[model samples]
Target: MPLADAKQSDAPAKRERAHAGAVRVVAPARLHLGFLDLNGDLRRMFGSIGLAVDVPRTELVLKRSQTFKGEGPDHARALATLRKLADAYKLPAGYEVKVTSAIPAHAGLGSGTQMALAAGAALMTLEGIDHIPSRLGEMVNRGARSAIGMAAFEQGGFIVDGGRGELDRAPPILVRADFPPAWRALLVMDASTAGVHGEDETNAFAALPPLPADAAAHICRLVLMQLAPGLMEEDIAAFGDALTEIQKIVGNHFAGAQGGSPWTSPGVGRVVGALRAAGGVGIGQSSWGPTGFAFAPSQEIARRLYDSAIEVARREGLEILIAEGRNRGASVEKIANT
Candidate 1:
């Protein structure tokens, strides 16, 4: 096979191994749209819906090294993830995992989950172990609340997970649908702030009251009737409308955790507000977000909206990028002998 470089990893790659060679895994960044049913009235909680985007991805390489080390953004976390995978699978510890690029950490872009999965999958390839993305996710303690990251890692698209139940490791994919190729997701990012995380996140959940069953039911109806069908039919109005409403409901419920606001970063919230008036739709914050997103029907419209919101984004010290929906999942490929 030809030598694998950065370009080769861009294509859809299959998992493979070569003697003493390097393996690269590209994990996509995902947007956690909203939770469907957080109340657990149906004996399930945190059923979520999300979409995978093409830009802002995590890419990494793994090869046998005399010493165990990792390089690049979140490399420290990557090393820890590797250790977890090694212990769980009984694999050797001698490996160098280089993270070439990664999504912004704690930006509500699923960076942590993507990093864990990419690191684990790279190690799995090098060791010739079983290749299961969800298993890798479980090994790294991902998918505790939403399995959207795991699902996006394995199969990028619009994903809906059945939520956590009796199962321990993986959540069932309730719906997986392709997003319109022409549609765009404009990301509103803030580098200065971080969303609620770790112990704080846990505490926030504990402090919050349980969601009302009727509210959960409303969200379910929105997803099942509007979002899903709108996506399938490529009706941005219907889909974006549903998504916007869902975000409102989920945001209001979590507002107490976010200082009585739907957004974690007020700057991001401001920019998203401007973008909304600029013709962007499906506006919402991702996860416990300092990062927010809005959708447009086409790149042209997205760019136009982006331009219109540039001044507002600049004032808020935020960044904006246009991204298409990713229909394909993460890829793993082996490079020639290192």
Candidate 2:
């Protein structure tokens, strides 16, 4: 990591200092470009696979509140949590939470998970709760099934959630790689279509084949032998190979659930093929997506691939987002003093 810091002013130089009345936080959106076997009692082999992208951010602003009421279950729960934290830490009495997000709903980007984690973080931090990234991730992940989102928000990078278990301590594993500064992740998402509904999602998995013991072992091999080593060395060739291997294994597993290859979305197969044809190194669909992603080596490669993908999708009259992998994550700014 570089020691020197470079600061660029986004606004003109100001002569005044403002008191902090609110805490602001930003959480990055994630792409589970690939999800493996379904979580079930019959199989101890299932795990979530994904990376955090630099698009569709979730931002939060927390300020002191006075006699505010929360209407929804999630909102009420959040308020209750914040109140408890405040009482425990001897902090302020009232607070307000304002959330702004660009991440689409149910596109498999982990948007909801990100928001939940960010809100939790803001609440905790404002109440003087001392926390490490991993601890904070664990705390927030309790509110949602997606632990990867909490991990991504805590430490920006490629990550995977180990998945919640009966033990209640599913930690995240951050991929060991220095994402190239020029690399960009473009998520081609279709918001018009809905993914597997929660009810259907559970039932779908229930009906799927139980994962064989060998299958989980094979996934572990892809992660350790290929993905882990390749990522650590920043070897695109190796990384691409590993991703391809995982895609095949995981894609096959999801097949039984969707009554097909489990590519989930009807339009993703063509895009994945198109991306590969356009010199894309690795490509896959996010969990139950109407969203597909293509990984390029560089910006030039990304542009070329994106163009090719757009052309191919045009034939089907389908639209997708062209996103880039971000080295650094989202940014949060304080817009007002109060």
Candidate 3:
């Protein structure tokens, strides 16, 4: 469903009015549009901008219980997250958690962070505990790096986080604005290839050279001058150009870690090239991705790009999805237990 239709169909106020036993929360997937500065002179690191997408989200249902139990995909991770949250908050010992729908893990789509927050939010709501995302994130051992996922979960849209410096808090949101309604993003992923994660991800960062000063300067300028302004004015072409430029700089910065090409998957470079050739714009990868995205000015254009790229993606065994930008954050509802 489109975001507006989804909102109307699952209105939280209406659902809450009929509350009985369970709390359900839906959190969007995020596209990490490269970090602002991986090598800042100050303690600040990984300032980021990202867009939240409606489909392929993390959905959870939770209810208070005597002993913690988890069901559905990634059940073990969900249970562990809940236990950590309970331990950190000194909350009650039990909650029954179910992951009804889960974002694909380690796809560079911010799945882990969103799942943690969804689990935290549902548990807190069921227990009648008041909590904000930052505290919830800290309890769940997230937001240690970038705040874009946490902030996007709380209030979706195109988000920019100022980065964590010396503070232990969530990175402050430097800006938040609704992505243009007419613009659509095509998310393409190679399911056969898993993105870098766990110890490997940590080591990749440790191994990466500091981002060149000139490149960092260029990124900062692009975001501040072109990207931010283009979004504000709903200028799709300008925004697309700025995004492409940023991706080129950041992609090259990590080329060594991801083999000679900036992309993690073998054919992703060709796919991106084909999409651009087909008139898709704003091409880029999300985080440590095998998943990549590009933008279109309208639904028709998005579909055309998707149709054109479907063959290329199929040849490479990629999964392609055309999704609209999620202007609002997550939706939490209280559902009656049957």
**Which prediction has the highest lDDT against the true structure?**
1
Residue range 31-56, candidate 2, lDDT tens digits: 77454444455333345666766777
Each candidate's lDDT (Cα)?
A: 0.86, 0.60, 0.82
Report model 1's TM-score to 2 decimal places. 0.93
TM-score of each prediction:
0.93, 0.77, 0.91
Model 1, 105-133: lDDT tens digits are: 98999999999888878877776666577
lDDT of 3 at 229: 93
Q: Any idea how many clashes model 2 has?
A: 12
For TM-score, the strongest prediction is 1
Query: What's each prediction's clash count?
Result: 0, 12, 1
lDDT of each residue in 1-338, candidate 3, tens digit only? 12233223223333343235888989999999988887877668779989999877998898767899988987677778778766655563477888888999889998898988888787667655566887677766677778899888988999988887897777889989999898899998887777788888889888888887778888888999999899889888889999999999888888888877789997776787789999998998998898998999999999999999899999988878988889887888777763
